[model samples]
Structure formats: C-alpha cells, structure tokens
Target: MDRPTNPTLIILAFFAIYVIWGSTYLLNKIAVTELPAFMLAGLRFVVAGILILIIAKIMRLHILINWRQFFNTIIAGFLFLSFGNGVVVWALKFVDSGFAALEISAQPLLILLLMRVLQGKKIQLMSVVGVVLGFIGIYLLVSQKEIIRQEGSVLGMFLIFLAMLSWGYGSLFVSKADLPKNYLVNTGYQMLTGGGLMLLFSPIIGEKWTSPVSWSTEVQLSMLLLILFGSIVAFTAFNYLLQVVSPEKVATSTYVNPIIALILGWYFLDEQITLQSIIAAIVLLTGVYFINTRKKLVLFSRFSGKLSENK
Candidate 1:
C-alpha cells in the first residue's frame, strides 16, 4: 500500500506565520524604543528587499517587465507598502501594543468593504454578520484599555485606525493590480520601491535617524529577528500561501495576529487583558472563521465533499 499523505509541512508553515508574525507587534514596539521608528522599518525592508531580489535573480525568476508593469509595481508599492505600513509604524510611537492590535484588527473588515466596492461582489449574509460581530469585539476590547485618560491615546487610536485603512487599501491594489507573472518578485520590488520611498519621506516627517537613543541587547536581537523572520521569511511564506490558498484563507492571519499581539502585550508588558478582551478576541476570531470558511462550508455541503480547508 502507498504511505499516507500528511499535511505536516502545511501545518508547520501555518503555525510559523500565524504565531511568529502575530507576535511581531510587540517586537516592533520594542524595536522602535532603541532605533528610529520609520527608519528602523525602512532599514528592515531595504535589507529584505535586497535579499529577495538577489535570491530571485539567482533562481532565474524571470522578472523582466514592460513599462505598464513597472508603473503598476511602483503604484502598488507606494499604496500598500509605503502608505499602509509606514502609517502603522508611525502610529506605534503613541499607541500601546494592545491598542494598536485592536485598531489594526479592523483590516479584515476594511478589506471586506473594499472588495464590495472594488469588485462589486455581493456581500454574503454571514460576511455582514461576521463584520458586525468582529467590530463589536474590537470595540469591547478597546473599552478595556486602562491608559486612555489622555487625549493622545484617542489620537493614537485614530491614527491606528487610519493605518489599518491604509493597509487595507494597499491590499485592494494588490488584489486588483495587473502586474508581472511572479508575485514574489513583484513583492520584492514592492518592498524595495515602497521602502525606499519611505526612507525618502522619513526626513519630511521629522524622523531623526541620527538622534541618540537607548538600546537593549534584547531589542537589537528583536530587530534582527524582525528583519529576517518577520519581514523576509514570513512575507515570502505569506505570498507563497497566497499563491496556493484562497484569499479568504490568507486573511485569517490578520485576525490571528491581534490575538498573538494581545497575548504578548499581556505577558511581557503586563498590559491588562480583561475578561471583556478575552471574550472579544474570541468573538473576533470566531467571526473571522465564519467569514473565511462559510463559503467553503456551503460548497462542501452541495458537493458532498468533506471540508479540506487548510487555513
């Protein structure tokens, strides 16, 4: 008899992206304390982009392109990487890791709305339900914040919300952009061009890279891990999964990241994760599962196929 097939690699890869990437919000917070925020993130992409470009060339990834594709890549990069991610890093200066997590958790909902507007896909019933439930959950979580006495936290919250929307807009472009054949190579250019643009804009934003700052050995190690694991490895794995999996499945990682961020915030920062937050996280995650898997459930029932959804 033939040996049984296993999904061990898929499972491990899923966990690696889910858990490792999820924990990165706290890591990013720590990283900014030691280094300039935008500059630090800028450096991360600069390095990761170069590595990806080198690897793609060595693998003969065939990234040659026409002018239209070139323009598309830069546009997508500026929107997705520069505006989306740059805003998040900038907001982190005033936002707590948990607060940031709650706000950025809105990306899935934002993406849902964007898809409706951009593609005119009819919003399924459960999707609307899921969106409502997820937002309620996040609203509850934010209410549990203990550090919001000042107006700055409110402003920070607004900024984080903007960051999520920016990122969601970027995702919309990524889905709709007509670009080269290889998505990974496109990601390389996206990171490089967007990150380079961010570097150029850092001074405009008054990001003083040469400003002296305190550093911890742990923070240094964390930055290294983020540049390698979070920026390079996780993103490549993410794009790989995107190629192999459904868009809805890939979207689960967005919801999952906040859970991990919440945990790290509680464990390391001693930021209180209230009973309401715990319940809210569960609600949001449940909503995400429903949003992503409901269509598959309906299809499986119709075809009499057992569910084989992997994300």
Candidate 2:
C-alpha cells in the first residue's frame, strides 16, 4: 500500500508519537499496581510482538533478515528495551510515579551527552542550551512540597536517568545498526530479545508468577491496550516517521511526550500537578527544542564537512 504523503498524516504521526509515548509511564504505573512490573512489561512485549508479526504477515511486508541481523537486533533489544525500558518498571517499585516520569523526561539531555562522548559527535549549540533549560525545568517541577520531602526519590530519579541514558544511547545504535530495513522486522526482533530477557530476569529476581494464574479482566484489558497502542500503534508511527521526517523533527516528540505524560498523570491518577511543574514544563520544552534542533543551532552542521575532522 502506498503511504499517504500529506502534512496531515505527518502531523498526525507526530502527535501520535508525542502523546502516546508520553502516556506510557502512567500506563506502567497502573499496570504495575496489579501486575508484577517486569512480568507485566514482558507479557506486554510478547503480546505486542506477536501482534505486529501477525500484521506484518497480513500486509506481506518483505523481511530480508539475516542471522547477523537477528543477533544485532537481539543485542539492541537487550540494551534498549530490556535495560532502557525495563529499568523504569524496576525503579518504579520504589519511587513516586510522577518523579519517575520526570527523571525519564531527562533522556534527550543524556542522549546528546552520550553521543558526543561515545560516538565522537560534536555537541550542537542549541542542544547545550536545551540541556541547561531542561535542568532548570526539572528543578522547578520538583518543587512540590511532598516530593521535596522524599530524598530516596532523588536517588531513584538518578536511576531513571541511567535508564534513559541507556535508551538514548540505544537509539543511536538503532540508527547506525545494520538490520532489516523493514520496521516491523526490526521491532519484532527487538521485542523478542528485550521481552525474553525481562522474562528471564524475572525468575532470577524471584518474580513468583503468582497463584491463581487466571488474570483479572482489568489486567487483560491493560495488556490489550499496551499491545495495541503502546506497542503496535506507537512503534509503527515511530518507524513511519523515521522514513518521512528528519530525525530532529521526529525527536520533538520527546518534548511532546512529557506534556502528555504530565496531563495523563493528572487525569487518570489524579496526581497533583503543581505550579512549579508548569514552570518546569516551559523550561523542558525549550530544552527539547535545543536538544532535537541542535543541528540548526550549529553553524558548522550546514558546512556538510566531517564534524569529527573539524574537532
């Protein structure tokens, strides 16, 4: 099927990514409440992975996967999904949901920093500014009186940063890695590797699969929503944008997701949204603009020369 090439589709795709991905934190909170965190996420990926594979089959998508691709995807999956994402579920066991959300929001800063350090990429000027603003925003947002009292959450906040650092670095690897060009195939492999690892870890961590194996309808429904929206729809939208938009533009969704997360946190969990969080929101978006659009901030980026050679 020929994909639609319109401003509308592009805009919708961006929005879907922005809002849907952002709300995933709250979903994790709810799902974790009734279900084991790692196990729940594991089941989610397993279900979503199968569903995506099924859909890919129906669409007859071409998958030119090699053994090396599977291994690469598995490694990428283990790093990005299991460690990057799975850490959130693990940390949430001991932290406030909102605080966890905020910490994860700091990913772009970590990504930019890591890229410069690990990949020898030059830092974009605007992204540098964005990181500054993002930190300021975090400070402001964290001013809620009760949250201020939780020192351990500060530690947990740092842990989530580590999670996102892994996520951001993994994203770079995703861009550079040789794998199936088909998005579904890449995602399927990632889901399997990461999901499988989490399940494996669950047993080691003493994740008892719980007595009365039959799950409640609520758990079943949550699983369905995660598979359909979080896994299938959000990932498809993400991959589609990779083809249609500049990565910088698609990355703006990083900023957009936090707002969605904040709002969803407010709506579903009735979590208090403080005035400081609003101030922080502005700072965060500014940082996001800098982070994703740093190329524009760099005069040298337009030179089209080797950024490394200059450095």
Considering every candidate listed, which one attains the maximal lDDT?
2
RMSD to native for every prediction?
Answer: 5.7, 4.5
Per-candidate Cα lDDT values, in order, are 0.74, 0.76
Residue 194 lDDT (model 2) = 85
lDDT of 2 by residue, 119-144 (tens): 89987667778889888877776656
User: Compared with the true structure, what per-residue lDDT tens digits does model 1 show for residues 1-311?
Assistant: 54343467556667768887987788888877667766877777777778888889999898677888778878877777677776677666777686677667666677888889877978776788788888887777667546577456776677777767777777777676788778668878778887888888888988777522355777777777887888778877777666666677677787778888888878987767667767887787777666665564566465555434431
Residue-level lDDT for 40 in candidate 1: 74
Candidate 2 local Cα displacement, residue 140, angstroms:
3.8
How many backbone clashes can be found in candidate 2?
Answer: 1
